[model samples]
Target: MERIILHCDLNSFYASVELLSHPDLRQTPVAVCGDPTSRHGIILAKNEPAKRFGVQTAETIWQAKKKCPDLVLLPPHHHLYREYSRKVNDIYGQYTDLVEPFGIDESWLDVTGTLHLFGGDARALADTLRRRMRQELGLTLSVGVSFNKVFAKLGSDYKKPDATTVISPENWREIVWPLPVGDLLYVGGAARKLLGQYGVDTIGQLAACKPDMLEQLMGKMGLQLHSYANGLDADPVRSRFEKEPVKSVGNGTTFPQNLTTRDQVRQGIAMLADSVASRLRHLGLYAGGLQVTVRDPQFRDRSRQTRLSAPTHLIREVTETAMDLTEQIWKPPSPIRALTVTAIHLMEAEDTYEQVDLFGGSAATRQRSEKLEAAMDRIRGKYGSSAIAYGAAAPEKEEDPLP
Candidate 1:
C-alpha cells in the first residue's frame, strides 16, 4: 500500500505567535526581532505583510526596517512558543503515532494506517487540521499531502498561510514537474546552480536526466537529486520515538561587545563549554572529542578540534580542553566576536565506563570531578540557571544594557 504523508508547517511561526497577543497588527507589517543594541540584532521571523515588502529572516533589523518602515517589531517569547509547539504536536498525536517534527514549527505525519478513522480523504484531513489549529491556537498552518515525504513538504510550500496542496501519483508530474528544480527536496543553491549549468532548470528536466550522467557530473548528491525529481523517494516518516542519535552537542553566542582581551575570550569559551557539557550530561552522553570555533569581528570563522584521552561530560574537562584549543589557533587581543564549543564523537555514558589512566592520579581526579559536577547539576536544576556559575565563565556586566 502507498504511504500517506502530511507535512504541516506553521506559517511565520514566531511572528504568528506574537500576533496572538497583538491581533491589531495582523494586517500591518510585523516582525519578531532581537535587540539591535546587542550584537544579536537580526530578523528571526516576519509576517506576510512584512514579507510582501521583501523583509527576510537573518537580515539585520536595519535592513528589514529600511524595506518595511512600518514594521512592528516584537520581542520573542521562546517559552510560549515551546508551549504552543507541544500543544500542536499533542493534537497531531490524535491523528497518528508516526509524527516526526522537522523543527519547532513544522512536522511530518504518516497517517496511512489511521486515515479512515478521521476521513479517507487526505485533503479533508489537512483542512480540518489547519482549521483546528487556527480555532484552538490562533495559529495557521500550510499542509502538504502526498505518497512520500519530499512531495508532501513541497505540497506544503505550494501554498501559503492556511492552505493544503495534494500531489498524487497521477497529478504529481502535472502539478510538480514544471516547477523549478529547486522545488525538489535536497536541491539547494549549489545543486540548483549545477543543474542549471546542465540545462536542468525544471523538475521535469532533472527527472529526465540519466542517473549515471548526473552522478558523473555531481557525484552522490546528483544521484539523490535525480531520484527525488523522479518521485522515487521512499524514505519513511520515522516515529517520534525513532529520532536520530545525537552527533554533536554545541552552543555559541555573539557577545554584546567585541572581546579584545584574553580574559574575555576565556569567559566566552568557558560559558559555551559549560552549556555544552550540561546538555551532554542531561542526555547521558559523553564526548570523546572537543571542537571550538572562533568568529572574529569580520565574521570569518576559524575552528579546530582535538581528541580527548577519554570520554567525559564534565564542565571542567570540556572548558579546559576548549580553552587550550582556542589558545592554539588564536593569538589573543584579536577582537573575538563569537565563540562556540561543541562536544563531538559522542558515546552513551551507560555503554562505556571511565578507564583509569596508566599514570593513575588523572583517573582519581576525574572521578572526583564527576561527583562534584553531578551535584552542581542537581543544585542548578532545583535553584535555576543563575543560581550557580563558574567565576571565569560569568559574563561581564554591560555598561549600558539594552532595554
Candidate 2:
C-alpha cells in the first residue's frame, strides 16, 4: 500500500509570528530583520505585502528598503515562535503519532494509519489543520499531501499561506513534472547550474535523464534528485519520539567586522570551537575529526577537515584542531566575513577508547583539559553562558547571535 504523507509548512514563519502582535501591520508591508548596527541586518522573513514589493529573505536591509521603503521592520521573538511551534505540533499529534518535524515551522505527518479516523480524506484533513492553526494560534500554514515525503514537501511549497495541495499517484506527473527541477528537494544552486548546462531545467527533463548519467554528473545526489523528480522517494517519515543520533556538532558566526589578521581569525575559531566542544560534551560525544570553513568578504566559502590523533570533547583540543584546519584554507590579511567550526566523526563517550601515547604526555594533557572544561560547563550551567569564558575567545560585543 502507498504511504500517505503530509508536509506542513508555516507560511512566512518569522514575519507571520511577528505580525500577530502587530495586527495593525496585517495589510502593511512588514519584515523581520536583525540589528543593522551590528552588521547583522538581513531580512529574516517578509509578509505577503512585503513580498509584492520584491522584499526577499536574507537580503540586506538597505537592499530590501530600496524595493519597499514603507516596509515595517520588526525584531524576532524566538521564544514565542518555539511556543507556537510546540502548540502546532501538539495539534498534529492529535491526528497522528507519526509526526516528524522538518524544521521549526514545518513538519511531516504519516497519516496512512489514522486517515480513516479523520474521515479518510487527506485533503480535508490538511484543510482542517490550516483552519485549526489560524483559529487556535492566529497563524497559517500551507500543507502538501502526497504518497511520499519528498513530493509532500514539494506540494507544500507549491502553494502559499493557508493552502493545501494534493499530489496523487494518478496526477503527480501532471502536477509535478512541469515545475522547475530546482523546486525538488536538495536541488541547490550548484546542482541547478549543472543541470542547466545540459538543458535539464524542468522536473520532467530530470526524470527523463538516465539515472546512471545523473549519478555520473552529481554522484549520489544526482541520482537522488532523479528519484525525487520521478516520485520514487520511499523514505519514511520518522516519528518524533524516534530520536536520530547526533552525527556532528557545529557553531558559526558572522562577525560585525571582517577579520583581517591571524589573531582575529584565531579568536573567532576559538569562540566557535568552544561552543562546539561544549555541545559535544553535553551530548556525551567525542569528536574524532574537525572541519573548519572560512567565508570571505564576498561570501565565498572554503572548508578543510582533519582527523584527530585521538577523539576528544575538550575545548582546547577542538580549538587547536580547528585553527590548524583554518590555516590550511586561509591566510592572514585576507578579510574573513565569517567562520565555522564543526566537530565531526562523533562517537559516544562510552564507545570511545583512547590509547596512551607512550612516547608523549598528550593523554595526560587531554585528561587535565577535560576536567577543566567540565568544571567550566558546570559554572556556566549555574551562572549562565556569560558567567565564564576564555579571555581570548571573548567578543568585544556580541555579533550574529545564533538562534
| Cα lDDT, all candidates | 0.88, 0.89
Candidate 2 per-residue lDDT over residues 147-226, each given as its tens digit: 99999999999989789999999999999999998999999877899999999999999999999999999899888888
- At residue 390, give the lDDT of candidate 2: 68
TM-score of each: 0.77, 0.87
Clashing residue pairs in candidate 1, if any? none
Candidate number achieving the greatest lDDT relative to the actual structure: 2
Q: What overall lDDT, based on C-alpha atoms, would model 2 receive against the true structure?
A: 0.89
Off by over 4 Å in 2: 210-219, 297-302, 305-310, 350-368, 375-403
Give the alpha carbon lDDT tens digit for every residue of 287-311 in model 1. Answer: 9899999888665788899888778
